[model samples]
Target: MSDWIILSTALAGFDHAATKHKVLATRDYLARPEMFRGARPNIINLSRSYAYQSRGYYASLLAAARGQRVIPSVETIIDLSARKLYENAIPELEDALNKGLRGAEGEPLPSRLRVFFGTCIDPRLERFGRLLFDWFRAPVLELTLKQGDWVSISKVALLPFSKLDEKGRETLFQAMARYTARQWKDAKSRAPARYSFATLVDANEALPPSSIDSLKHWARIAARMGVSVEPITRKDLPRLANFDALFIRETTSISNHTYRFARRAQQEGMPVIDDPVSMIRCTNKVYLDELMASNGIPVPDTVMLIGPEDFQRAADQLGFPMVLKVPDSSFSRGVKKVASMAELKALASAWLHDSEVLIAQKFMPTSFDWRIGVLGGKPLFAVQYLMAKKHWQIVQHDTGGKPLEGGFKSFSLAQVPPLVLDTGLRAACSIGDGLYGVDLKETNDGVFVIEVNDNPNLEHGVEDAAEKDEVWTRLTNWFIERIAT
Candidate 1:
C-alpha cells in the first residue's frame, strides 16, 4: 500500500502450514504450476528448513518463477539467512529493540525473543517485533539479543518450522488473523493474478511518463490473464529479483534511479521494458541521429556541434529556423528552434557547457508529428500528436516548467501511412527489442524519424483509443511471453 514493499502465488509443501492460508508441497508446487495458474494463489511456505536450496528455499523460488506470490519470498529467505547479507539493517533493528525495551518493569530481557508475524510472547517487545517483521516479512523470527546500556539485536534468523511449539503455533495464527483480517480495513480481493510485474513510478515526479490511472488500467488487463501488476518506486530496487518482469513508468534519464532500476531488473534476468541499452541510446540525440543516419534511415538535415567552431558551419548548412538540441534532451525540453544566428549562438553557448555535443538540425514545421508505438520489433499503435496551440512542439513548457500538451488522434496500425510505419519500426528496432514510442515527422519530403523514446507515454484514453483494451493486452502479452520463455 505504501511506496515500497521490499516484499506472490504458488505455494509449496509445509510440515507446519497451520494458518488459514493455502499450502502445497514444494515438489507439488514445482510440478503442477498450472493447477493454480488462474487462481493467483498466495503461498505461505512452512517448510521444515529454509537452508540454501532446501525444499523451503526451492518452494519460494519456484513459486516466484510461475508468477505466484509466496512468503517468506526467496529474497526474504536468502537475505535473512546470512549475517553479512543483512548486516546493514542491524543498526536500525537495534534501535527498534531498545525502543521496545524502554518503560519496562520486565522479568529480565530474554537473550532470545521469538516473533510470530510481528507478535511476541513478551508484550513489551511487540513494537520491536512489528518493526522487525516490516524489515523482514518471515512468519517466525528469532532475535538474538545483546544487552548493555540498551538491548540490541545481535543476531536475527529464521526459527525453523520443524521446532515450533504449541504456544508458538497459537501465536502464529493470532498474528496472521490480525495481519490478514478484512474487517475494519479496506475490503479488497486477493484474486491471485496469473503473473506479477513491478511498474516503477516516481512518487514525487511532477509529470510521469505514464499516469497512475494508466498503470492501473494496464494492471487490470494483466489481472484478467492471471498476471498481478504492482507499482514500485526507487526504494523497491532490492525487491526486483522477486518479480517475473519489470515495467518502468517513470520518466527515464541515464543518470537517475530509473536507469539503475532497469539495470537491476536485467541483471536479475527478468524481462524489463525500457532496458538500460534503450535508455542510453534514446537519451542522446547525438547517438540517435548518427545511428539513424548510418542505418540509411531518413532524418532531417543535421549537424553536430562540439563547440563554437562548428557553429558557423551548422548555421551555414542548416540555415536559420534550425532546431538546436542538447544530446540528452527529452519531452522537447532541451530542444529549441533558433530563428536567427544570434539566437542560435546564444543558446548553444549556454547549453554546450554541460554537454560535450549538441545536435543542430533543420527545423521542419508540421501541424502534427506521427508517433508509432513499437513493442518487440512490431507496431502496436499509431497517433498524430498535434502541436500545442500556437506552439512549435507537441509539448510547451510554462515558466514554472509545467507542460502544456497538444491534442492527439490515435489510429489503428493498418491506417498508418506505409512509409511512416516502416520508418517508425526501423528506428525502434535500431534501439532494442523493447517498448518504444517512435516519433516521426511525415511531410512531402517523406517520413523522417525525429527520435525514439525508451519510456513512451502510454496514456489511458489517448494511446489506447484506437485499439481499445487491446493496446494494453498486447503490452501484457509481451511481458508474459518474455517471462514464460
Candidate 2:
C-alpha cells in the first residue's frame, strides 16, 4: 500500500470528505499528539447534496479534524496556502530537536521523525484559515516563525513586514534553511540520555504549600526522564553536596536561606535550575523592572519608592488606581490596588510599618493576565490567570484574600501569543535563569510585564494536570540532556 493509503487506514473511521482531506493534510503532523492535543477538530456540516465532489478533500479534512500538522511538500504550496504551522509545532520540533537530534546517538532517523510528526500535529486548521488566506496574497516570504506564533498568527505574522533588501532576504532565508536542515539531521541521529538531579524545597514558615507541591511534581517528572530526584528540605542543605545539581524551591529574599542555598550551589559550580542571580532578581521587583526596561522588554510603568515619602511622590506621578507592591512577595501577597491618594497614603503607611521599600505601578484594568513558565530559557506553558469575582489580584479571596478557588485557567505554551513568548524569553535571558515564571498583563496598547519569579510554583493540578505533567517531563528530560553533555 502507498504511504497515503497506510495513513488513511490509520484514520479509518471518519466518513466526511472534508475530514478525509484534513487527515491527509495533517498526515505528517500526527507523529506528535502531545504537541497538538488541545487543538479543536475541523468538521463541516454541509448537506448530503454537496458531498460527492468533496470526497477527494476528505483526507485533508480528516487530518484537520484529527489536529494533524500537515505541511505541503512544495514551498510554493505552503506559501500560497499561507497555512502557518500549529503554534505548538516549533516548540515540539525544538523539543524533539533538543532531545532526539542534538547530541543524541544511534537513534533511528525515521523513528524520530515519526515521533516528531505524531506529537506535534494540530487538528484545528480552520481556526487559522484566515492566516492561510492572507499568506495566499504573498505566496513566498521569509520570516522567523516560532511555534507560539502559529497559534495566534495575527500577533506574529500579520505585523508590518521588515523592508529587507533582496540580498538581505536571501541571506536570511539561506541561514534559516540551513538551520532547519541541520536541526532535522541532528534530531534523527541522536539517542536520548538520562541522568540524576536533586531539589531542595525550603519548607520555612513563609513558604507556601504550592512550593512543596511543585517539588513533588518535579520529582515525578525527574523520575520519568531517568533522573533520580532527591527532594531535601531546608534542614538537608548541608548534605546536598553529593548531588549533581541543586534546585532551591522557596520564596527567596536577598538574605534568606534560599538565597544562601543558591549561593552554595553556585559555589559548587553546579548547574542549578535557578542560579543565585535569579534568586536576587526574584527577590527585588525594582531590579526586575530595571533589567526588563534596559533590555527593551514590555513592563508596567513602575517607580520604586524607598520610603513612605518617596511612595507618595511616585504615586502622585503615576496617578490613581495604581498598584502598591512589596519588593518581595508572591502569589499576590502584599500587592494592593489603591484608588486615591488618601487611600494610597493609608495603605502605604500601614505597609511601611512592616517594610521599607515598595513599588507604585500603573495598574492595567484588565483582570485577566498571562503567567508564562519558561524552562531552560524556553517557554514551557502559559495560563490565563483570571481574578476572582470582583477582585483584581489573582490570589485574592474572601478570608484575608487567600488564593482564589476557581479563577484561573491554564493553557499550553502553544496557546500564548508570540509576542508574549518573545517578551518572556527576553525576560528569561535578562535574568539568565534557566527556570522562571513571567507574569504579563495585556493592556490596550500592548502586553506588560507584571513580574518574574525565579522559583515559580509548578503545582501538579493547579492548571491543566496533563499539560503540567508534560512540562515537568520535558523539563526533566532537558535537564538530563544538558547534564549528560
Candidate 3:
C-alpha cells in the first residue's frame, strides 16, 4: 500500500507552494519505500512548521487543492490559523466550514480542505517533528479525514524524554549542574546575618497554627540560604514587591485571596509557590475529575451536579452511600455522606443554596488512605492515614477532638505499595509538572485517587523523626534549585 502524507496548508501558510512541493516530493520518495528502511513512511506537517517561511510554496498548493484562482499567501493563512487556535472568541473550524469558502465580503474563493496525517522527522519543523513519529503510531488516534473540510487533530503520547539528541541532552544536564553550583555559591555569598521571612495570614480564617509555624521554619531556612522571609497582610500586597517570594499560610480556595496573590506574583515575574493555576486545579473537583480520568488514572466514581435536577440524577446513578461535596470546600466543611435518596435530596438542596457546583462520588469504604507527596516529577514521601475507630472519613478525629494514636504512619518510598505509587504518579502528572500531594484510597480491589492537593503542608515534626528531616531538606533544596534556575 502507498503511504499517505498529510500537510495543512494553513499550518504551512508561510510557503504554501514550497510546502506542497515538498509534500509531493516526499510522497514520491515514499513510493520507493525501500530507500528509507529505518523510519516509517507516514508524514505530517503542522501549522508551526510551514509558517516559518514557505509563502510561494503555500500559494501553489492552495491553488491546486482548491482548484480556484484565489490563492492565500503563507503569512495571511498562518495569521488566520493562529488567531483561530489561540483566540477564545473565534469559532471552531467546523463553523468556518459551514460558512463556505468565500472572502469575508462574500467573494467566491477556494474551498480549503484541512488535512491530518502522521509521520516521522521533518528537520524543518521543531517540536512537531519530534512528536510526529510517536503520534503517528499512537493507538489512541482515530481521526477520520473529510474529503474537503477542516478537521482538528489531536493525539496522546507519553511525555517525550529522548527528544533532545545526545549532545543536546548532555549539554543541558551540564548547564543545569553548573547553574545549581553557581546558585549555591551566590546564596552563600549573599547570606544575611539574621534575615527573616514575612508571609501573609488572614485573620478571619482559622488555619492550623502548625501550618504557620511550618512556613516560618521554611522562611528561616531560606534566610540561611541568603533569602529573607516576612509575613504580611492582604492590605500589604502593594509592598509585596520587596519580598523574594510570598507564601500564603491560610487554606486557599479557588475564589480566595491566595489566588489573587498568585496572579499578582505571576504578572510581576516573581516566583510564587503553589501557583494560581495549581490552586484552580486542586480546589475545583470537576477539573480534578476530568484531568485524572482523561489521563487514565483510577479515581473514585465522580459526577458533577450542575443543578437540582442533575443532583437527583447523579445520586440515582451513583446510588446510596455516596459523598456529596462542595467543589471548593476542604476539611470536610461542606462534605456530607448520604446513604439514601432522601438524605441526598436534603443535602443537595442545602448545598445548592450556597454553591453552584457540587460533586457526588461513590463512597469507597476503605480503612486507610495514602498521602503521597510529589516534587519535581518524583515521589518525595508517602504516608498511610488510617481512619479513627468506627470513622469512615480519613480526616476524622477522636471523641476528645484529638488526632487518634497510630492514626497516621509515615512510609518510605520503598515501603509504599507498587499500586499506590503508580496511581499517585499518574495523578500527579495529570495535574501538570508541579509540587502536589496525591491522596489515594486502598480499596478491596486496588488503589483509587481520592484527592490531589497543590499546597500540601510540610510541618517540621509532622512525619516520622527519621523521615521528617529528609522531607524538609529535599523540599528546601528543590525550592532553592527552582528559584536559581
Alpha carbon lDDT of residue 34, candidate 2?
38
Candidate 3 positional error at 176, Å: 44
Model 3, 351-464: lDDT tens digits are 767654577999888777788888778887787767757778765543465544336778888888898998998888766566688989887777889888887655566543
For model 2, residues 276-368, the per-residue Cα lDDT tens digits are 656655656655665576567888887766456576677667888899887667677778888888888888888766554467898787878
Worst 10 residues of 3 by lDDT: 183-192
- Full-model lDDT for every candidate: 0.76, 0.53, 0.52
How high is each candidate's TM-score? 0.60, 0.55, 0.56
Report how far off residue 216 is in candidate 3 (Å): 3.7
Q: Any runs in candidate 3 off by more than 4 Å, and if so which?
A: 1-198, 202-205, 396-406, 464-466
Candidate 2 structure, TM-score to reference: 0.55
- Backbone clash pairs in model 2 (N, Cα, C under 3 Å; residues 3+ apart or in different chains), count: 46
Q: What is the C-alpha RMSD of each candidate to the true structure, in Å?
A: 19.1, 21.5, 18.0
